[model samples]
Target: MSIEPAGHGIEADNALDRRFSGRNEAVPDEAHHDGRGRFYWFLIGMRGIFSLPALILMTSYLGFAAFALDVGLTRSEAVFIWALPAQMILVGTMAGGAHLAASFAAVTFSSIRMMPMVASVVPDMRNDKTPTIVLLALSHFIAITSWVFATQRLRHVPRPYRTSYFAGFAITLTSINTAIVGIGYGVVSAFPPVVAGALFMLTPVYFISSIWASARQPVVKIAFLFGIVLGPLFAVIEPQFDILYAGIGGGTVAYAIDRVRRRRHAAGGV
Candidate 1:
């Protein structure tokens, strides 16, 4: 019912404990106030609609929508493509006259990045008591930003409220993205080409910056670096299959490097 400053939840919880617990009484956990906890976190998630993560997602979808419009896709088609769990590369293929099978393949391949995210995040938020349908449904919301945000913040969130918090965050993010995609498509032609170019460029720039800001693991950093270096080169060599080849080669190289580094460290010298 009330808004607190960011990062104040722990302090507030401590204060609540001091106020509520007597000398002989044990402090109640967050789940003891499950309804309030979920409501509070849900509100927090909804309030974060204007934050950087949402902005990045909105800009990226905007760029995609604009491109789809330019390539003669109808508004409904554009929304349909955006709604699909595919990356922008699949949409690019569609725009470039690729067949249905090729588009599906590219989309599936592009989505492999989501696998690690799913494997890492779901277990943290779930328990044996959690329902199968809940896990299955929430998996759809496990994109890059949501995964990063949830991985960090859910540690502080109560077990019972994590799913509710995430649902609110994901819903707010996707709703804004869906709306912006339509807006971008409608406005792309209304603006000049120079402006349109800048708008479209926002997507890739935001994506790279988001990754650069969030990546901490050595293997991930190395993989991203190799991908950046190899992507253009592979594009030049064979444009059609560039994403697939670059991802495979870059990931392999990074994994090899990481294994070598770990082995050396284990031997007590690196």
Candidate 2:
């Protein structure tokens, strides 16, 4: 096997990052043709916006909005937080009253999850000739919720329309959830403190449940288990850096385990 230089990997990641940083609304007219057309897939995507999991996702965001209000963020601020991709960081910063630099560091570390997620999903949605800007815009719509839906739904969607389909699903979900955040912030004051607290826990609980239900690979399952176990421990040890530590530690251990398992299987097969 041939090994690539470190610079090659850096250049590749830079290219991917650049694709997402730029903004473009138009998809190229000339791309792969899959007969069903982009609009048909887009309609299919719109149909998926109301899937049961999406309802659950809304509840989670509702809980988050209430939690943000409970922590003293104004209604507008709570809604503003929902607009950003760095949910965990924004929540942590607000709850812990951390400084901007610390919040930035935590958010950057946590966002490592998105890199692999985008890399995995984008190739399926776009061909080599798909405009980089269009690919970038679609990638921005990819958070944990939409990523799960996109990966599963794309199997049935024709290749050419996958991008448009994801666009429809993602945009619809984002728009609805953004509105729900505002609604939640407004209504939270009416509920009892205990109920409001429970609402605060809803999003994290839903996220864990989703991961448990969706994981098919052993390594991913292992990583998730490690994260679950290590999360509380690290939170106690270092509250602000808990997620950063758990993610890195859990993922590294899982990767090592997977590598060994693969090697053993290869040896046995040989």
Candidate 3:
């Protein structure tokens, strides 16, 4: 792929786009890409420092580090992984003497949630000139916060700049959180259960607000709300599969409702 030159004005950007626009076949990502583009997006991505999600994440992880201490983990072990769920599962398994196979399975299932998030944002972030490998590497950094930010904000960014923008943001966020975990490990270790629980709740509150803010379609909104409401009822009836049941059952019902609505709309329009 002929890498486009970024950090230039809009006219230069447009010129590069026109020059490369006709090369339709997929090319290796950024084989010829340069430092200027990377630097530009790095600056752009670092803006997350002041974002609400980033602040909330830093606070939540501060609380989570206390749990890591309880699990008998080193600061290095806790800082090694970025995803909270994966870190929790792997650390818990290690502490509980769970086998490698079981730990792997649990982590994979936790990662399954990332697939949809990656699918939604990555394509828009990539161009034909982008390397598939870059996309793959960037996918590793896409937790719920990054995914939500990218989906909601990246579309407004120039397409060619999207991947770099994401790389910068994700890298910065990861680095900051890792530092937070490492530095605050001892300080937060003695946090009481109530305070830790409250800090943990911050992440979910952000998730709920973000999902609501990002949902453009009524059907999508209904599915999210359905899952939220069904969760408690399902928990009472079948605790083990409450989340699974709430998710799949709610999604299936919402999908069916959407199809019927579409059909009715088609018929009524005709």
Candidate 4:
């Protein structure tokens, strides 16, 4: 006779149940769901004021200034000659055909990674399509830092709110990025090379730090470590193909390891 969890309607033999049982415990109270909601809203509100200014100043001073140096222009010359024109083009092109094309490409590429996340959360959403599409659209706003933070710090949030929380996070980040790009053009000339370099380091450093902090699963750790070690080696061989090779190579390795582990566990149980 088949057995099931009493009153829960879930079968005892459900693979999903087994997976959840094997997963880590929920996040603690200091990182509670309600507190995270408050923080998320706070970040959204801050985006219009403090975040925008900081982003603009940093991007202009760091990214634009660094680009200037790379092209052998003095800071002033770079700002006036290169940065200004570039900013103008970016802003102007936002409503142009190229911008639309780039946006479509970005959306298409982003959807590939996003679909898995949506699928994972679909049950939690009770198969609600409206919220799913809305959240998917909102996901375009997400960058590495917010994703890491949301995944690590907001474990208590019900599945439905996770998308909304991510939406808020992405919106805040997008505003900050836009503001930074705008401000960076004007102020890049005033910053010294060292200061500019520091600014340029922000995005990369944040991404690395977030990944290190958020990666919990053995499979993820293996994939990431392998990707890191193999990425440069492959890049040296063919820079354009490095990412493709690393993803396929690392994914295959991880899948093989998982398969072996599962087989051993099944054998042991038998």
* Highest-lDDT candidate: 3
lDDT of 3 by residue, 192-236 (tens): 889878878888887787667656556877888898899999999
* Per-residue accuracy of model 4 over 90-151 as CA lDDT, tens digit each: 43344344666665554454345444444434443322424556756755443334444444
Residue 80 C-alpha lDDT in model 4: 47
User: For model 2, how does the per-residue alpha-carbon lDDT over 115-176 read when each residue is reduced to its tens digit?
Assistant: 77788788768866579899888888887777767655564454556788888788788888
**Number of the candidate with higher lDDT, 3 or 4:** 3
Counting only residues 3 or more apart in sequence or on different chains, how many pairs clash (N, Cα, C under 3 Å) in candidate 4?
A: 3
The C-alpha local distance difference test score for the whole of candidate 3 amounts to 0.75
* Candidate 3 residue pairs that clash: 29-130, 29-131
TM-score, per-candidate, Cα-based: 0.69, 0.69, 0.78, 0.55
Scored by Cα lDDT, where does model 2 land? 0.70
Worst 10 residues of 2 by lDDT: 1-10
Candidate number that wins on lDDT, 2 or 3: 3
**What are the per-residue Cα lDDT tens digits for candidate 1 across 92-190?**
787789898998887777687677668878876865567879888988988866775665455445556677778888888888777777777867556
Q: Judged by TM-score relative to the true structure, which candidate is superior, 1 or 3?
A: 3
The order by descending TM-score is: 3, 2, 1, 4
TM-score (C-alpha) between model 3 and the true structure: 0.78
Q: Which stretches of candidate 3 lie over 4 Å from their true place?
A: 1-38, 192-194, 231-249, 266-270
| Model 2 RMSD in angstroms | 10.7
TM-score of predicted model 2? Answer: 0.69
